[model samples]
Target: MKQAPFIAVEGPIGAGKTTLASMLAEELNLPIIKEIVDENPFLAKFYENMDDWSFQLEMFFLCNRYKQLEDTVTQYIDKGNPVISDYHIYKNLIFGERTLNGTKREKYRQIYHVLTDDLPKPNIILYIKANLDTLLTRIEKRGRPFEEGMDTAYLEQLIKDYDDAMASLAIQEPSTVIITIDGNAVDFVENPEHFTEIVSYIKELMK
Candidate 1:
């Protein structure tokens, strides 16, 4: 039986997930779903005091991601076509561990595991990797107010967590479809070759 087509572009902050998602959607003639960052009412405060607002911020993201997944899952069941998203369901948990404290982290793990139980996994994941300097530069270039005081320490920790998660994911689902791409080489927002490469890759995946 042919499975529903789903594609995800996942990476740490400033990795261009949103721009890539949008471009992929355009090329594939699919709708785009991005992270609910703007919807988070606590994001500004969370940026100011990560320790205090980490749990709260993560909870908001968890809820938002679940809802986003629900919508996509429904579409897959009904329409049986392609969809592209900026982030995957489990990426929320990745951020959760980096942001939440010990006790809250445990709770986050439990909820994340439960919420993702029946969520549809992507047919292919495009993982973008970039160094800290590149990431920081991209973050600043974007000029989001909430990202103004972003700490390098927090970004570094997220990088480690993302690496650990991808490594474990490879182990747990050895056969899962994945493609690791170097973000440093790709400028989806500015250049054409990088965007062409990404679109080409996704086309191959679809075939």
Candidate 2:
């Protein structure tokens, strides 16, 4: 049976997930769901002192994201409305594992599973993979104050973790379709042809 499209654009920070998600949503006329980032009061301080605020920051995101999916995305998709989202909810765990220490990480994991278990899973994930330097440059250009102090080492690890998570998700959920995009390959933003090509590719896959 042809499945209803529930698309999620996923990758580490600065990988252009939101940009691509917007592009796809516009092309398909789908409702878009973006994560609540700037609204997180702890986000600014969390970046500055990760060790001190990891749990609080994570819990805040978890609650907010849960609300978004529950209130908006799920409601639309249940009525057969296609949905596109910038961030996959699972990234919370990928990040929580890296930032939260032993006990904290374990506790967060329990909470994450409890919350995400019944959440709607994305049937299509656009995994935008970019090189470290490319991501760093994009992050700088975006100029978010909280991201100014982002650690290169942390970003590097996130890149690796995201890739690993995608692979595992593919195996565990065979029904989910993952479309991996090479960020270094094309400037989809600056180049219309490249953007069109990406959209075309996604259309073909969705068919």
Candidate 3:
């Protein structure tokens, strides 16, 4: 039997990672591993005061993501079932580095590396890119209370950080393919043609 592909969708906050992941999963008939964002007790508090709660929030995400990936590998990947994930484990570092600082950041990095060293990496990554204005508008439309007061400067910095992180991943994981999708150009949520285009691209890639 052919090995199943593990695809991950990544982007900064409000970049539609979840939306695109859902679309791909449905179109391709793949099982999805979604992020448990609202379930994190520290998320709302961390967004309110990042300085005080960053470490806690990162740790919470790290543990949960680790568990999810481990379970996914055993239950899905090992069975040769195609898997789609909303966020990749590497995202923990992307957000952690931005949230934590100095000694705290280093400590978190140590823990993250140790925990993730043996986990399976995604075969392909679909990185969604959108302008800040588009992202803010989507965030507003989503109507998440914790995200309503998100700092503009922070979001701008996050976009830069995400770019840097993706670049670094390209270099570090040379074998893994990264596909960039223009979120601003295509409204996958509204336009069927745009969604079909993306699905077609992914099908070609997988083939």
Candidate 4:
């Protein structure tokens, strides 16, 4: 049988990924998988001393994300339920590249691949691409306490890395549909017309 539609909304931090994903989930009447953030005990300390806390933070996220994806497969995808997710498993790899180094990174990758290798891939990836200023503004508006004094340099590099990874992912997984949306130009949250436009667009694609 043909696979049930799996839509994954992905973007750099503060790009409103969860917002868009939830909206899509509601519009499409699909179950939504949201990422676990801020629950990490090491997150606050990681910001204070990245060298000391990077591995721990990363491991916590890796394990949590793995379990979420695992459940996504057995609980939803395998049973033919269409699903929408705020993140793709590849996010661990993207963040790991920036936070990890040497043997730590190598081992992290080993663990990542082991956990994610069997997980179901998204049939459609809604990639929200926004300018650095736009991302920063949104991040500030959200006012997550953990994000205070965020590193712009790190954010800039992460954006580049995400874009690069998306490019590679498209080439690597030609069967997956990759749709990039300009977050700077579109106000999906406040503009009803824009939101409806996106909803209509994605509905057509789902067929």
- Best-matching candidate per TM-score: 4
Each candidate's lDDT (Cα)?
A: 0.83, 0.88, 0.91, 0.90
lDDT of 2 by residue, 1-207 (tens): 354688889999999988888887888787899998899999988989999999999999999988888876447767777788998888888889989999899999999989888767889898999989999999999999999979899999999999999998999789998988899887889999989988887787667
Per-residue lDDT of 1-207 in model 1, one digit per residue for the tens? 555668888889998888888888887898888888877999999989889998888999989889888988787634787788898787887888777778889999999989888767776788888888889998999999999878898898887887788887777656557778788876777888878887887787778
When 1 and 4 are scored with TM-score, the better candidate is 4
TM-score to true structure, per model: 0.93, 0.95, 0.96, 0.97
What shift in Å separates residue 84 of candidate 3 from its native position after superposition? Answer: 0.3
RMSD of each: 1.5, 1.4, 1.4, 0.9
Which residue pairs overlap in candidate 3's backbone? Answer: none
Total backbone clashes of model 2? 0
User: RMSD in angstroms, candidate 1?
Assistant: 1.5
Ranking of candidates on lDDT, top first: 3, 4, 2, 1
Q: What is the per-residue lDDT of model 4 for residues 83-183, given as tens digits with 9 covering 90 to 100? A: 99999889899999899999999999999988888778898998999989999999999998988888898899989999998998999788999989899
- Candidate 4 residue spans exceeding 4 A from truth: none
Candidate 1 vs candidate 4: the lDDT winner is: 4
Candidate 2 off by > 4 Å = 1-3
Give the residue spans of candidate 3 off by over 4 A: 1-3
Error of 2 at 175 (Å): 1.0
What is the RMSD of candidate 3? 1.4
- The TM-score of candidate 1 is 0.93
Q: Model 1, residue 21: what's the lDDT?
A: 85
**Which pairs clash in model 2?**
none
**Which one wins on lDDT?**
3
Error of 4 at 200 (Å): 1.4
